[model samples]
Target: MTANVLTIAGTDPSGGAGIQADIKAMSALGAYACSVVTAVVAQNTCGVRSFQALSPDFVADQIDAVLDDVRIDAVKIGMISNAGIAEAVADRLRHHGAGNIVLDPVMVAKSGHALLDPEAVSAVREALVPLARVITPNLPEAAVLLGREDDWTVQAMQAALPDLLALGSDYVLLKGGHLEGEHSTDLLTGPKGTRALKAPRIATTNDHGTGCTLSSAIAALLPHHDMPEAVARAKAYLHAALAESDALDVGQGHGPVHHFHALWGSGV
Candidate 1:
């Protein structure tokens, strides 16, 4: 059976992140992609200049339209710009009993511009985190979510994982790329316990949409019903993407990972 995945996120004109990246990642991984745009961003590899948020009602309508027609196997949520949109999405998903919702708490861009409003962080915690099957937060994002300093080490990340789990997600995949490590390690914690995914960090500037891609990849694999397996596969997929990105040049600044790397046989 074909698995249909929905991504509720912002639109990135650069196509490196947000709904565009989610769609590409899901489709590349052999799943059909559907999207509900929560915001429209004027962004590029350089950074985000500005963004326009969609109305909450319209966002809800998009969700309803997709869910009414398709057998959505999983959902991946990205940059929700405000509390209202977050609340609307949470309400709709809860009402529909949406399963396998992967929430990627996108706070700042790769260039350090804040994508999510500072005040909206609380809304995401109250409204969306509880409904998510898994929450994927990078080191900086995890620090923001935990209300701690950004200089968290691997031990600190491990210590904070439980608090993230306490926020009501079935699982939390704490991405450790921002930590100063030779190998990027992502810690996945859930009802089954903790599993660590370790991979050699590919030295490349083309890592713009990594968080979006990884979470969407997880969403694509969720129909198989093994969260740990899905996370492992997604990490492998991400590694391949980074490795394949060596040849392609999408932008002058930090470019996007080659998501179609597997199709071209360039990925490991």
Candidate 2:
């Protein structure tokens, strides 16, 4: 069967992040990509200038249009900017009973712009978080979910495993890239066990779409493998993208990872 991956996210006009990155990442991994935009973000690698979120009904209509026709193998969700949209997503996906869902809790942008509304945070936690098969949250996002400060280290992430596991997700991948270190380590905890996945940190400013890429890659790989295996494979793919990222100059600020590194050849 042909694999298909569906992404629900906001638009990044610059094409370095959000729905753009999600599509690129999934398609690069040999999955047919489909998307439903929940918001339109006027942003770049530098920062988010502003954004306009679509109505919850519009978002649901898009979801229904896609789900009504295509048989999606997996779904990658990111950048739900409000509570109404979050609840809509949760309700509809449950109605369809979509499995192999990967949710990236995108609270803030790499450029320090807040992508999610504070009031909507509760809605996502209450409605969407539990429906996800895998929840991928960065340190700061995890902190926001836990109602704490954004200060996180590998130790801190490990210590917070119990709290994350309690959020009803069968698996949680706490990203450790924001921590100052020589390695980018991600802690993946699940109902089965815990794993510390480590990859050498690629030294480059081109890391704008990393979170979206990783989660989309996970979604693309999930139909073929288990959650842990899918995550590990996705990490390996992300490592290659990051390591070979220096070639693309998409913007003046933090650039995007090289999605076609294997085919185009790396500049580094």
By summed lDDT, which 10 consecutive residues of candidate 2 come out lowest?
A: 259-268
How many clashing residue pairs are found in candidate 1? 0
Relative to the unseen true structure, what is the C-alpha lDDT of residue 21 in candidate 1, on a scale of 0 to 100?
90
**What are the root-mean-square deviations of the candidates from the true structure over C-alphas?**
1.5, 1.1
lDDT per residue for candidate 1 within 153-268, as digits (tens), equals 87888899899999999999999998777898899999988988899989999998999999999999999759998999998998999888876768788898988887876524
lDDT of 2 by residue, 51-154 (tens): 99999999999999999999988999999999999999998899888988999999888878899999999998889889899999998899989998888777
Q: What is the lDDT of candidate 2?
A: 0.91
Q: What is the lDDT of residue 253 in candidate 1?
A: 83
Tell me the deviation in Å of residue 244 in model 2: 1.1
lDDT of 1 at 127: 92
